[model samples]
Target: MRGYLAAVAGSEPLTPVSRDWARQRTDLEDEVPVVHEETVTGRRYEGDGIRELRIPRFKSVAGRSGDLTQGEWAETALAAAVLADARPVLSPRWKSQQRLTLGRFTPVTHIRVVEIGCVDASRNVLFEGTPEEAHHRYVRMAEARVRAVKAGGDYLPGQGCGACELVDICPAVPSRPGFLGVDSPPARRRSWSMTTARDYRTCPARAHLKDLFLPRAEAAENTPAIVRGQAVHTAIEELHSRSPVRACASTDAPATPEHWRAGRWEVTGFQARLGTQMVGDHALVCPLHELPGDAQVYPERSLVVHDPDADVVVVAKTDLLYRRTDTWFLRETKTVRSLDESDPLLAYPQLALALLLAHEGAVPGTTEEGTTGCRVELERLTGSGPVLTELDGDDGELLAQARRIVTEHATHWHADEEYVARPGKHCETCPVIQWCPSRPEKSAA
Candidate 1:
């Protein structure tokens, strides 16, 4: 992004004023440095031709710059139309940066608006044309998407519940006062999830830094194993999302599992092959297998519930949520190099949330009477083969164990004010170590 910015800013004397921008000077090939910042409303950019509405992508996730869906194009076009119609204004921040005298900023409408990407500063335009053209595209393509967003219906319990003011009264998120089993009052309203719990247990600073959305080292975060796991999940998810839902076949595994590619995630060699085996294993124990065609399946569904007593929103993203007639089953899938002899719930604490939701009959569509029709399952795809485990949601003993695991994980996190670092081996792959105050310095080799 800095490279692109520097290229466009095109400063004189081949010298960029900002030290951050100067860092990219060596790598920047096209430098048309300009101090003038253009804006429509609050937007800021430099240069001309078709005025651009840049979509900034900071993460090295699987995606392209200009390959947008129709709805996405429509949305971007609508925004571009707004930019085209509005007059430009010089931002106060830019003026301050230039150390210029503040004065009335004139508004001048531009004839065209173009949507572009900031990742590589490429001329890969998603949309470009006149304001009228953009508006017509939006009405024809994106208006329904806009309408659906505004016409909110069912109460969804998810990550947003933590910041939601109506969580106390939300019909979907069942309030489980004293759920975290914490005696002290909360320091502030916060959200809790298996990921947060796991990260906090590993290192509080890791959790805090992640919550702050600090830039991470992509190489460390997207290791081969991690990418392989993601690929396997993506393949399974795509299969589950098929129109007129069909059960995954044993032969459905990728033909080239040794070099599998899912979206932007490409894995090769051993990891890729193992991921393929995992995908195939999933077919042996697919929840949709043998189910009726009308069976409803929600893959990668997020469930949120509020704990008013602890002032935390408990969030869980289940791998699969499917219903067979009256009973609803929540399935959690795992891909492991080898299956070890350990408590499944303890090995993968995320399952605790699924178990608790099932036991409490909290998932949407659970029978009003109780958890009679709710079931929880664990599916492991190991090197040997696939193993399926079912946890009776109505089992009191299992429910107690699940509750204990969740509370144990949430207690310290809820009480923590300073997410102090616990640097150790985990620091080797810690994505946010760059921002950690306690990060250990490397010794001279």
Candidate 2:
């Protein structure tokens, strides 16, 4: 009897059982039954919050499996319940379900299969899939669509390849050849930091220019806004190094008037002395200081620190390095719209990279003696500025992910000649649109 039972269990089909088979086999509905039903109509509703839109008991026309067993239904129900509670707590920027039609069948697949995406406020799967994987898939799909359209084979207006950044570079359009001829001159490619390399991977042409051709001027001209932000940040560090420091006892309170003026900065607005509202009748003075610097200020010098395992280089511009007693502090200044300690980009990874570069231990650079911790001062230029915050584990993760992205993208870029475009909303703002071969002729109004 034991051998028979074992054989039965082993030989049982792994294929999902049909809903009818499950219903006939056991009294599962009686155990964990569907309780709620709509009053106005005879339709049954499960109290588990999953409103079953449709449940086709029959096999699909394509001869695919149509069986949704009691166990599978239970799993689906639990998934729906979890999704119900989860959607409300998710981020608002995530993408929802993606609709695709293959031949005559229109199937809507939830983005969750991709693994990495933002969640909506309701905890619903917004952008499904890993961002990196999705980006690559989109690039390949856009390339195929562009090639088809350019070959004049059943290409529809506003169809596939429309969102590609390289739509203007397609050979189908009349002006594309002329445009490529004019802009395809051989030029020297320039070197870029890991951050710049990762950002440009979104555009195939830009990636080719920087990674393959190695042009000096073209690469410099197409640097992303984030890179420019970093450059400006380094310049602020230089300014901060030349200025004096004012230590504050209160976390939210401004600096003292005498200490504020001691720094090499100008003051714009000042309020008069008011009533003292101290804890023990002590007088308190609030002073605001404005530093004379712009966000466009570029660093005069930069130090490159190379990482062999990561296959990239970190560009660091240290503004101030000071030693107090036995420990040394590496101070970096940043200009952001707002500062939050929880933000990874502004915290640990950035500081860690800076510290690693300054120590000259991880990469080749100037070595500092007796370095203990790094200080990051986030300065907002609009109003009362300069809020100092410390970073930890979260920041480190961001840096690691960024490094991985850069290395992976660089590897793909060097291996390919025709870098394909990934189409999306970003394509609307692409600069090379007019030159794309896949672009259709504009209809006259």
Candidate 3:
């Protein structure tokens, strides 16, 4: 009880009784309560009364005045009732002795009421509530904690990777790309990008390993798919991206593209296998050094949305976002051999996240036509044309899905156990197979 009290002491007033209590009658020694056949005994208190809102315990309090809030007293009162048998009551102090006394704690009734009140520095009365609710919560929390400890379960590092501070010794941290490695870029829990959204949804365990636990594997970036994807996105970013003007740009170029974003990035096709692997595993670089003087399209632009409900920052850099005739068009490109809209981006999170940011006016000019009516095209370079899909859902439905995915991913990452490992064909293509024990053995061709 005192620990809980100590945790939140002094947010408001709890007891109205004055600490500078004065002796009213010569029979003052008669009021102390009896406990365990002992004369209501406690440590002798030099002060007339306990300080207002301070938990009645043997804490090393310096003096009666401090910035303590009244809320602490409420918490203290609850703790006193829950921890009624604690040693603070053994001291010869006045308040400590009366805690178990003849007030309301009786054998016939289990209800324990500890009256508490306090006055603030402004001379305002602070805490006033009864100890019943706080005590109930305290008991429930205590039982839950005790049960968990006895079960021998402990907090794991992947749990709350975003908030954890002890990553240095965490076992799940990867070897090569320890956030310190320059080759492996730091990633966010909710990058607001389609890849991150899909990564967590498809293989949660792999997501945790790659993003939270394991250091990035060495030479992973030299692989064919990674090199090719980067080459592709870089090509497109320079072409259709509304990304900020490059430092290498000529002085005559317009720094700001018209009505489009210039900076959004996606490292897609992770572990993706082309029909036949690249023999030398070299990057397919296709640079567009020249642009049409009258180009209206913009390539990549950064977008950020803070989902108030989820308390997470959703971020994405649009591959291509353009406004046309009061209608906005969102384009996402891929370098895969095949592209299909049949398996629509689950909840179309990337586009949906962008749409939400655009709708809320966080990213202006995302869609003059409106979020639901906007057009999103998945431009697969290997295919003849981009597969077309409309942003179909309402804002609420999309936000709800994003929130659920982001929250569940973070919660699972930090949970005592590993994220659920559901095996499927995708496991064959999982990038973190080195650390994923659940990966199925592939038959030699």
Q: Pick the candidate with the highest lDDT.
A: 1
- My TM-score estimates for the predictions, one after another, are 0.69, 0.31, 0.35
The worst-scoring run of ten residues by lDDT in candidate 2 lies at 272-281
Per-residue lDDT over 327-361 for candidate 3, one digit per residue giving the tens place of the 0 to 100 score: 55566655555655444445344654554444445
Model 3 stretches astray by more than 4 angstroms = 1-193, 218-229, 241-298, 323-328, 339-349, 355-357, 360-362, 365-375, 385-445
Tell me the lDDT of model 3 at 92.
35
Candidate 1 lDDT over residue span 273-343, tens digit each? 89888888888888887787767889999988788888888889998998876788999888888997899
The lDDT for every candidate, in the order shown, is: 0.71, 0.32, 0.40
Query: Candidate order by TM-score, highest to lowest?
Result: 1, 3, 2
Candidate 2 lDDT by residue in tens digits, 1-445: 2322232243223232111100101123547743221111111122222221122221111222245454443333333322222211122211212221112211222212101111111111212333343334434443344334435663221222322333333332112111111122222222334333444656665444334322133232333333333433332333333335322123322234221221233222221011001100110111112323221122223434322222223344444444444333444444443445465443434454453343333322123354444333322221234454443322566445534443443455434446566655544554444344444468998
- Whose lDDT is higher: candidate 1's or candidate 2's? 1
Evaluated at residue 182, the lDDT of candidate 2 is: 18
How many angstroms is residue 201 displaced in model 1 relative to the true structure, after the best TM-score fit? 1.4
Clashes (N, CA, C under 3 Å) per candidate: 6, 31, 58
Model 1 residue 279 lDDT?
89
